[model samples]
Target: MAVTLKAEKREDLNKSVTKQIRESGYVPSVVYGKDKESKTISVNSIELVKTVRDEGINAIMSLDIEGEQPVNVMLYDYQKDPLRDELLHADFYMVNMAEEMDVEVPLHLEGEAQGAKDGGVLQQPLYQLQVRSKPADIPEAITVDVTKLEIGDTITVADLPEAAEYEFLDTEDTTIATVVPPDTVSETDEASDEDAEPELVGADGKDEE
Candidate 1:
């Protein structure tokens, strides 16, 4: 289900107006979609943060703009204050529920790999996956089980189970996770050994240059 978020139309585009909006605990935002005119708006900063925290980023939203009908939307992008770590602005993309769209979904590994338990290193090359699905059918995340993975074993996109709701857009050979033998020597250790000064010794057991 889509979460409903109330928003107010923004009229003033001046810097002062934007500063005031931020000071008032609201985030300046814009809503746009294909064939639809873009609208400038603002939403309560606290409410927006809470919604995203509770619902995953891929969660669909019902944007209730004042004086207009609600529209199905998704949070496309956002900006934040680098120093203050505060939300500065946001962008909402109005979505057509019936049309399929491509989105990146987070990938999660489930369970401990047998290879890792045996002292092998487990590596995840791809942490997210490109998926195509309708707005309502979009998944929160794609999970892969690695419990059975042994050393040198890899899980690729093709190994994933087929799903009717969404399709993976990545190439079949794209590796998601893998296990490999642990390195005997780290790069730092190797560099240190190479840079070490050699000890001098004589045939008679006396130190000599």
Candidate 2:
């Protein structure tokens, strides 16, 4: 389900004005579509945070603008306070529900790998997958089960299950996760091997002076 948020048109576009808006407890934002001009607006900070937390970045949202019909949008970009982690600003991309759009959706790895349980290290190189799908059909996330994976085993983009509504944009060969054997030698062991001296002996099998 698409989350709904209320917004009011904003006239101020300066940095100072935005800063003041943030101080007043509203998140300044912009909405733009390929067919329409961008418009600035503001939403309640508390409401915006809740909506994002509940819907995530992949889901479509309905923005109810004052005096206008609600528009469908997706979270496109955002900024945060470096020290406070507060949301500074956000940009919502107006989307056509019937048209396909490309987006990056998070990949969730589920279940413990058998190799990892047996002392092999598990690594995940890709945390998200790029895909193209209609706004209404976008998935919140993709799950990859690693329970059966063994040491040296890998799961790639090609291994993902087929979703009829989605067209994966990532190359099929991209690796998603893997398990590998643990190291057998320590730095101390390597140094000892390098420093050990060979035994010096005479031709008659006696130790040389």
User: Top TM-score: which candidate number?
Assistant: 1
Summarize candidate 2's per-residue lDDT along 23-97 as a digit string, tens digits.
Answer: 998988999999799999988888888887888777688999999999999889887776676778889999998
Q: What digit string (tens of lDDT, one per residue) describes model 1 on residues 7-105?
A: 999999999999999999999999999999999999999989998888878889999999999999999999887667788999999999999999999
lDDT against the true structure, each candidate: 0.92, 0.87
lDDT of 2 at 78: 83
- RMSD of every candidate to native, in Å, equals 12.4, 14.7
User: Model 2 compared with the native: what TM-score?
Assistant: 0.85
* lDDT score of residue 116 within candidate 1: 96
